[model samples]
Target: MEKIVLATSQIENIAEILEPENKNIWAWIGKAKKMGLSDYALGILPKLRIHEENEMEGLWLSAEEPEYIAEILEMENNSISLGKVKILELCSHAVETLPKLKFHGEYVMERLGLEALFSEHTAEIPKIENNSIWIGKMKRLELHFYAIEILPKFRIHRENVMEELVLNADSPEHITKILEAKDKSIWIGRVRKVSPIEHAKRIKGKLDFTLITPDDQEENGGD
Candidate 1:
């Protein structure tokens, strides 16, 4: 049995009830969580680790609503972030929040091709925000790269060859390196190009490069 005490501050409230030297803090936290006092438990936890969200809408909704996110983007503090994907979902599903977004968010949504609002608009959406950090799962290369190796977005056919920095991801040499980088941000210099491949058909234009798949380590073509 545990003794119960009442106090003002959180620490005073906890300390009055339990002696830290005699009590198992971690065990108490576990008991508190099991007893459905999670919010109360969190008041004493020293560190926090968040797991991934099971849904498109994540914890950011508690910070601010979709309207607030739209307002932040519109007003040029794109600095304050809601998840980009989550914002996209909100803009798609919650039509009420759409008008809250101004030019910048509208541009991104249109370029992402998520909504019909800009389907008829012809003006090009500009600004990739060169310094912004992008994080998302991406295919190692483009559809064109499946047929041919990497095709650099720009043709510097003969010049700037030394500037071409190639990264062979998932290679045997980098297997441990990637594993080491799992929890931390690996310093990738920049993303000069990104192409989204949403839909595709059989490549009737002949595959020049051999195709590899993870399952069975199968190969498609060689000669």
Candidate 2:
């Protein structure tokens, strides 16, 4: 069998190739790590992904070929939010191994460092901008299917905040795609009131959310 290596740009092309299917195949993605070709490069590619939504744990297998396996991964987007664990991971030495291209590595380190500081001093923890409360779905992506990478999101709150931003974060009955669909139950933070793009855009949407500042901390775990 031939080995296949993927790059960030190539993964974008690959991302479009996978769609949800009933074959019991899936690919779980974790950004900030194991994204794009990071899995292939970092020697951490899963031999198979678990179809948790399918009532199976560690039951799905990757394709025999590497390229084919990547295709299989593109199909499933089931994610788990190890909320607090992610926090610890970010603040620890694991971050030292992050990719350095485009300052991506530096950005995460800075974010985690800031989070470490916030967790120690803040009255309450806020979910950061890039972080999520939705940990994906327990079922397949059927009625709930949407994408947000193209949208120009406006930060209701400012960055580098010294004040605590309050947000009512929660997780609803929707399946996540690219995002973790983070689990907000474990979160403790705040969010600002966003302008009414439509009255419900801020308070309600496909999924519920929690509050976090441009600089805040997750508890001690994450996906």
For candidate 1, list the clashing residue pairs, or say none.
Answer: none
- Mind giving the per-residue lDDT tens digits that candidate 1 earns over 54-115? 11221111111232223223433223222222223122212222222221221111121112
Clashes of each: 0, 31
TM-score leader: 1
Give Cα distance to truth, residue 65, candidate 1, Å.
Answer: 18
Q: After superposition, how far is residue 151 of candidate 1 from its true place, in Å?
A: 16
* Model 2 TM-score, all chains together: 0.20
Once fitted onto the true fold, the runs of candidate 2 whose alpha carbons sit more than 4 angstroms away are 1-39, 42-44, 48-69, 79-84, 87-133, 136-189, 192-223
- C-alpha local distance difference test of each model: 0.23, 0.23
Shift of residue 164 alpha carbon in model 1, Å:
28
* Candidate 2 per-residue lDDT over residues 1-223, each given as its tens digit: 1123343323455443244451232243422222223322222233223222222111111121243333323332223212221111121111112111011111111111111111122111121233322221111111111112111111212122212212211222111222333343222223322221222133223233343434555223222
Report lDDT (Cα) of residue 170, candidate 1: 26
Please, what is the TM-score per model? 0.22, 0.20
